[model samples]
Target: MAKSTRGRVNAQGDGTSGLGMVVRFTPKARSEGVQQLEKGGFRVASSKDFRSAVAVPNDFDGADVQYFERFGIAIVRRDGERLKPMLQNAMQRKVISAARPERSYRALGGPQTMRLDLAQVGGVATSLDRDYLLGYRDAVNELVDRLLGKKGAEGLVARAAFDETSNTWGLQAIRAIEGDLSGAGIKVAVLDTGFDETHQDFVGRSVTKKLFATRSSEGDVHGHGTHCIGTACGPLRPTSGPRYGIAHEAEIYAGKVLGDDGFGTDRSVIAGMEWALDEGCHVISMSLGAATQFGDAPSDDYEQIGQVCLDAGTLVVAAAGNESSRPQQIAPVGSPANASTILGVGAVDRPFVPASFSCGGLNPGQEVDIAAPGVDIFSSLPDDKYDRWDGTSMATPHVAGVAALIAQSDPKFRGWALWARLIQLTKPLSSPARDVGKGLLQARGSGEV
Candidate 1:
């Protein structure tokens, strides 16, 4: 084995010397005390629930001593002897770094892209060490395993109702277009948390392309996007007939714009949008929103990219948001959703009743476009763990899928034509405030599409 030396790690802090392999440990084995040295000369700098931070002794000339704490244990100093096995064994202990402390943000992606502010406080360190960090890799594998199982299909179908055996809406939507029909032949892009690429629904499915705005390519660290994709166009498995997606056969390009923590930045999102456009996706579905607003319309960043998509014959769909209440707290519709051409979608429950949490119209006039069944909607999940989640994040895809269906049903319609067709097909809502603009999403005249 190559000789080991104590030195700096990667910018992300994997603990590798410039010329040596970085050491790592399994989560279960990270706590064993590797060495114990007296603490008389050190100053305890901080303390947290599990570990205590201490400044190394000024005279700490050797690398033989080990340090201990609840969060992690490590060898801080060693004698003049070369540390081959010592360094290799030290890798078994959770390797902590002065920079890039472990947090969910780092694993999902770096904080800069996610837009989270990290203020340094003298106290407990981050939970993730190299091994636990590597656990994300295992976590992703577990998700794939679950997605590959038979229950994966049943899990999504079960979301229609708590106990209902029938996936009525999902079934109806699939039947509307079951055969060989090229609808618009448009690319539908889904920018959400992540997706289980191993799911049978997506097996052999053409991923015209995919890009992770974050560091990892793991499937939905959270279920938001997975569920949305299922609603938009989860493939048809053998056992699960007809209860797949609104645009069951349409091609899907997934962009992981959000982190496992389900929070991401305007920059990362813009990057995702740009990638989707570059990939030639015809329609972009974003089941995400930002509370921060710009001027009367979307900011330049939102407008610029959205316009590019629109100009390129791509339609952008965004969630109206899930932050509405009395006196009407408007969260500005945000970014691409607020762009002139992009469609901002609101949410209504299964019974067609406007959901109280659904964000209201951007302005007093007819600003918000359509509403869809978002309340506790059932859809696919990561790791094959299925559950119903309620959010406009769930609502936006319904409309995107509808857009895809329209594109497939009427191939002649491109950019604006598809946009206009969807608006014209929707049924107006009884409550003006509840269903601000065009109202509930409906395409095929009184018949199911």
Candidate 2:
């Protein structure tokens, strides 16, 4: 943890990462205090109601309050009304913390070679010159690799450990090739843009889905979610490509939190978390993130939500946002993933080197917890198509799927139990813990007794 970023959490959001306010209850509210909730002036939202709580339904004079019983949290919204009185009233008894603005987080990856449009990544600053330089430098490096046998910063080993004849290089690198491919009884929630519910590859698999974001339905138009889902819980043997998925038998719970345009607010993200818990999902995999600045504190609301969710027996795995142009700059891990309890995942390439854009734990307590193959990774996309992409976003699901396998292999793996085992199973790399954390992820092989 860096000294500059240490200290009290910015639970108020600071309106930098997002807009709208999210309220978390104190420990006292855990007793199911109906009176405290009622007096706080909020009604329990229906389990099926995944609407944005910030939209003040019916022109209420003050703030519109909706209490979600599942998480013991409230969302208060006032379109144009005074908020101090209402907030003070709740803060007096029910609200432990309240934050402003709901950040609009985006899908964290795109085309294989540094294709991130820095402008859309909001909050995380990276110059256009840096992006151009990254591309030019990488191009020159590739040219060098071609002219003079494969050699670069990582240097040439006897032979690189990558080939996709039998499976995707990612699966091979992580040793998921021979690992447990069956997560039969485990339920994994992939909370993102949603999955291709009707994609040909998933024909007969049991996939449950819901729309937390206001979209026509839960189908994904942004391809990123489909790619992520395919990695976490796609088919054991795809219709065409080499084996790319893990936990093929794991029941898929697809929650559409980010919409078609690849953007969603904090409200939708939290709603997805609550729904995943309500469905008893064993693992929640999020490949989305809101940008964060150096020394910027993480959301206390998210921190509390993460702790509560973990205690409830579900582990949340999220991407360490691709907000860096390393060597030139390294950014802090983004929100939700930076929420201490959530497993923050970073990206590594074929050489086991950290991806250029992979964010680091520059902020206090925001360290990367794990690493997985994320660069030039092949996986399913929407409409039955497939392609390679890059980002820490790609690494997260690899960890989530593996966690599901661990959960199925042993019934006791949940929350921190699962968290610890995953860390314990990693293969140490040369990279710093700040970049690769515990190290490269290795599946608890199917052959393991």
RMSD after CA superposition, every candidate = 21.0, 7.2
lDDT of 2 by residue, 1-449 (tens): 11221222233432343244455565665444435444655544543443434222222223355456666665554331344454455555554544344467788887664454465447876545534654565566556556767542223331234558769988877777675448899999998887886887889998888776644355788888899988988888899979899889889988888888888766677878887888899999999998888778777767777888889889999999999998799888988789898999999876677899999898889889999989878899989899888988899999998988888888888999999889888887766889989888888542351
TM-score between candidate 2 and the true structure:
0.81
Ten consecutive residues with minimal summed lDDT in candidate 2? 1-10
* lDDT to native, each model: 0.53, 0.75
The local distance difference test score of model 1 is 0.53
Clash counts for the predictions, in order: 12, 7
Against the true structure, candidate 1 reaches a TM-score of: 0.58
Regions more than 4 Å wrong, model 2: 1-19, 29-63, 92-95, 113-161, 215-217, 445-449
Which lDDT tens digits does candidate 1 get at residues 1-449? 11112243322222332111122223355433222112223222111211111212222223233222222323222222333434433444443211111111111111112122335436644434433433454455445545754121113311222222445353342233434433335578988776786666667766643444444445576667778888777654423433435666777888776766776544345546766776677789988765533234343334445666777778898887665653455444544455566788877654344566666654433257777767646566665545555667777777787788777676565677778888777765554543445766764631245
Estimated TM-score for each candidate: 0.58, 0.81
lDDT of 2 at 59: 20
Report the C-alpha displacement of residue 421, candidate 2, in angstroms: 0.7
